[model samples]
Target: MMAPATTSRPTSATAPSTFTSSCTRRTDGVTMCAWRDSGTRIVPTSSTSTRCRNPATPTRRTSRSVNSATRRSSRRGSPPRSIPCVRCRIRNRRKSPPGRSARTRSRCRRVLSARRCACGIDRIRSWLTRTRCCFMRRCWRSCSLVLIAFVLAACPTKTEGGGGDGSFEVQDPLTRRLMDPDATTDERIDRVLAEAKPGNTAALPALLRVMRHRSQAAFLVVSDGKARFGYRTVELRETQKDTRSMERVAAIVALEAINSPVALPDLVLALDDVNEVVQNHAARALVRLGNRAGIPTLIANLDNRILQRETANRLLEEISGKQGFIADAGWAERQKGLAAWQEWWAGIQASDERLPIEGRAYQIGADAEADRRIGFFVDVVGQYQFLFHEQARKALIRIGEPALPFLREGVERARKDDNATTRAGIAQILETIDHPNGRELLRDLLTDASGSVRARAAEAFGNLAGKGAIAALQGVLGDRDPGVPIAALDGLGRIGGADALAVIRRYVPGEDSALQEAHILATFAASRGREQRDRTLAMLLGVSIATRNAAHAVLVRITGDDAGYDSLATESARKEAMERYRGLLGG
Candidate 1:
């Protein structure tokens, strides 16, 4: 019945005991593990893979062949199963010793990727069907269930975090720790930095996962702020989320340090992040990557006071080879430079050109991105909404040189169709832009049949005033339109010096007339040189407070010195300030 007793290799007394438990072989000849009778543990099914102590030969997955094989094996009566020392191996594997997870994970990966599963469920099932052992057939159902329980209870599911994509499973321990949810922020960040090596682009998704999840409670601000004086002091009590999580920050830095070209888009999108640190880091990384696509955010950063504007400005200069970096320029002054950069970048995009990213030339051709931007803003230039109009006006100005032709065309159409409002709006923008190329354009606009356009053009010349515009301003003084002559006088006042001042004196109304203040302001604007200012200042020395205020305003505009005049101060106080100004003038 026992098929003749057999003896195998003798065991050492010093080693742990094994033969104390036994597995019986059925008359039909399939062997069972002793652990089943003794109830010992084996490797639990988790991310790690393991094996049965007495695994049977494996079978193919196709059910039909397995059934045919089973039928033939039953009739042939062949003995094909073996029983080795299963009890001791099962006892040893029941609980893994410490420091074994990484090795087990590695081994499991190899087994899952290159060989049959460790539990051999299919092999045992196939062995059960082929053998004529009645006792083994019953064991097959329970064994399959128990093996499945081991796997499901302890093994990683197909969609577990780090190795969800079997193809992208993380092998490096530090990388795996970086993605661990329960790890402290510092611990995670350290692990992320540890993997900052070349060819680690495989970990980019993990790095970016930390970047995009953005939920680290980066700081514990015990107090939001305590107001000690007029200002609230939050110096030591602010969250990094109020700034940006260092873990995420470290991840981004690691991405750049890793120097993978594929990180370009992540850097670009980070340019729009709410946190300034993220944007700054992203911008710097993108510049190093040699990608022109980062141009938009850099331009946007050009005006952000919190950003390194000078650095951004310098980068723009080097990247685009254009110069308009006015460090002290106000928003109004910056529009032209920013617009120029936009136009150049947009033109490149529209032309089906590649702005390299990640060491590859990725080209995008968006005809309408350039065209539609200029077109929409050009159409909105003279619209009714004040805010929208201002935005359109700025956008058009920022579109820079490319937008000029369209703006010129719009002005011409307005003039031809006698649309005074539209015509005047275009003239106003040209005045604000003061582009030298538009001076000729302004000269044509000053003669538009629309009186309102002529007035706006003359006013534009006042701001655009230089010696060359003197003749143009003087000619408009004789126009039949009353508003045009006043506007021309305003333009000449800012230019023509003594000669223009003499011309202006004729238009000054009688002291009692309503136009006196208008002429008075023009006289103030015309005084450029000391001689002219002396004559003008002498005239206004004893006039209305309003008149002195007008002269006071003009002096500050033409000359950077404030001249100590305070419009809000009493008249005698103003006189004292005026005396100081006249002394500075050496009048």
Candidate 2:
């Protein structure tokens, strides 16, 4: 019959009879035969990849049939085995014409670039070539599967905000530093705070991690160092400043700086942080955010230790605008109040109504309308975003003396609150109120028992009372709190008189802490036309960089020139700059 069509198929001796080189309109989606392996070609295949290729010219015995051996072997009931799948079309890849699918193009990249995939494919080929067809039909399949399992297991998984408990990337370097044990990094924290804009929630995950973390670095500590997990007396460094208990406090500060509603849930939940200091910070953040969700937690803390009870009542007063809760009352005294606080919180919750609260740091008063305006502005001033705090301060000043009674009341109430930032914010409103009503109250606040309150009030008095408040500020010069004296100096310097300068000159450098001395020296620059401006110049030569920092910053702001004065520079360099500035100054 036409010489039996002169069959062109190769005999078994010439090539493996089971090779599948099918080229019959392959829908494997690959088109070009770019890469080739001689003898037995093995290519790795995965769900996302195909490492095998078909020959360009249809080399199934040159054309009598494609994949002739595979079909033949299958019909003979040879249990199917994975050979180099020649019909698995090789991607045209670089040769692929325009309009090739994105999927095909991407697959082309993965096959060529992924070294592991290429190696795995090469290995599969090696295994197939080493084994006879009979052996490949059985154990080779198992071996290939094990190898693939190993390759896939080595790859890391990609994720996006998955459950929010895993690692994530943030643009700020402070993410790790803020969350880690050595979180005393204020320069990094200030950088992050400067960017804690309304829309920038990138650092929110890291901030939350810090709030939720209660684990402090456990190492040896000196006897007097503050310890959260109780103290164990061990001989450590003699000059250790403070302990690691301040770690979470840094995070709470950053979160408040973020001033975003997105952090509300995390801030509320952080109220239960094992460290009461952290708890107090979280409570203040929630109040400034204007959400009463954490009120129950603070109220629950009322039944806790006296410290927690005092903190709870303090935060509760801010939220509810009521101040009847006595902070130092024993548990027996506060137990009844605890039940009342819980009931009050529950009732507000059930009604789905906003609590009649003043703010995180201020309070409402008998005058509801004025209380509303003051609270509204008070909340705005605490939000640092978009210069909203500055704008709100201007608004409160415009409200004038009529708002003073409530504003003064808010500042007094702010004393018991632990959020110094919020306390300072409320104090700033009083400082610039321009209303004469709060002047005496501002003077009175300078002598309050709380150091922070006294410090805040002292700074406020300079703006509210000016030269008139000098006697009050002088009384505060010998105050026990290191910051109080500095605050008093700042106030007196703002007033700038012979009397104020005389008080400023009384600073005996060794008598106060370095920071206090630094601050006092900085105040001298604020007191212009005084001969003591040279005192600020002298402070620039101090050993403590913090002391120099305060002095340098004030000089720069006042003179509008640094004179190459770098507070962070070497001691000799600082002295040089100080000399240069002295040359710039008269005497």
Candidate 3:
């Protein structure tokens, strides 16, 4: 009956025995197919079971069933050698849609673009390999190093190329010219210097080069050091119109080269030389030297009918110590003191819009009740007072007689019941005026109530030092106030002459620990030398005067000496630079 299910199934399973075992009957009367391989069984029971075998004849199937059962028993004893595939209902229905994943697409696009870019780069690399300049890299590196070095050098430092020290050194172009053997330049320079009144335009460059010894001083006079030097010597000697002119230019080179007071007399004579060129150069040289040697001569030259007032003014501006080096030197050098005093007085009078005494009285009354009222008004007056004092002192020696009367009146009035304000102003004004009353007033004000007034009085007394000022100034030396004593010390320092050393030594004491040491250092040669000079210069640089006072000092000190004190004028400029740098750094 089941006659044979074999009736429907193949006897030898022509369908290629996918099932490895024969059919078998279960206890429930259900038939099953099974297969066996390597002692493992594949049995199909439910429709959900996995099929890895084929079914054949019952005999073979029966054998497979027995073997499959045995394998199953063994499989139960041992673990599976390979994992079975898992079937997930969710995976079957889920579609990936039309596009590949974003990551895969991006990767593919990148690979394509990279391949193209690489191909292009390969072409460029090949071209460069064949045709690029061989020395390009070397040249680039060398130029870069040179540029870096230039940038570093241009940045200022404390080394040899730093600060103003390089200002005095030879430049590259000048160096080249000096090294040249050609006589054309020498001849050309000779003819230029030989001109009767050499226009500064053509002569300045050649002169500067020659002066620095960067170019040959061929247009200069024949001298002991340069007679056999070279074509420069010949050209210079040949260019001289006369011995006088030669001597004048020669003196300039010597002054510039030597920087000595001994050259003063010769320079003074040249200031009055009949030749205009000689006079101009000599005056210029004296101004350049920046010592008292040429100051009297320069002042005396002011009387020249032919010299323009503008020229005189220019010369005055040039020679006056706008920064008060002469002040640092003290007014004892009468010529320097007078020059500075006159310059200071002139500046004060020119800028003063108010009646000097009346204005201070009104200003003091106005500020009398406010918190900082006194200081505010004092500062306002002090600005003009200090500025003018500085300028007047530098140029007054040149002004001489013109400044006396004003100086006398202020000094005379300041001595009696002078309020601190009035006394200070009067003393300051008198400081520039060399008249008798001016000296007397300043001397008397030395005993005033206020420290500032006394300071002003002491400074004025120093400025007024004549035979008359000695006793009064020395008396001021014994004042009770420390600043008063310091001021008196400064005055004595500037007024040095016969009573100078005794007074200087009286309070000056040992050069080592005195307050006057700064003032004393540059006024005259102390027992100490360079050390004194350096300390004095440091004091000048470090002393923190008010802004206008500092500006006035810088302007006056380098006046005339720097062609116009341009280098020295930069004291204020440096302050401005600091401010701007601070802003940039967000400080």
Per-model C-alpha RMSD: 28.0, 23.8, 27.7
Say which candidate scores most in lDDT. 1
Between candidates 1 and 2, the lDDT winner:
1
* Candidate 2 error regions (>4 Å): 1-371, 383-386, 412-422, 433-436, 447-453, 464-468, 478-481, 496-498, 501-516, 519-535, 538-549, 552-585
Question: How many clashes show up per model?
Answer: 9, 0, 49
Number of clashes found in candidate 3: 49
Clashes in model 2: which pairs?
A: none
Give TM-scores for every candidate, taking all chains together and pairing residue i with residue i.
Answer: 0.39, 0.36, 0.26
What is the C-alpha lDDT profile of model 2 across 304-403, one tens digit per residue?
7777778778777766776647767776667778777878877876885665542332223533433544554454444444344554455455444444
In lDDT terms, how accurate is model 1?
0.55
Candidate 2: C-alpha lDDT: 0.54
Off by over 4 Å in 1: 1-369, 412-419, 432-437, 466-468, 496-549
What would the per-residue lDDT of candidate 3 be over residues 1-587, giving only the tens digit for each residue? 11112212222324312223344433322233333333346432344222112222222223555556544643343212111111111111122223645323322332332334444667545534543334444565698899999999898553211112222222334323422334454553454344324222323333333332212122222123332221111121122223223433543554444433323323444454555445555665655544233444444544444343234434545554343322223235535645664676466457843321121111112222221211222222222344423322333233233334433443444445344554576566566666665565566667667888888887777676676666776676666566666666656555655466565655543343344543454243222222243333333334454323423342233222212222234666645533432333233
lDDT of each: 0.55, 0.54, 0.41
Give the candidate number with the greatest TM-score. 1
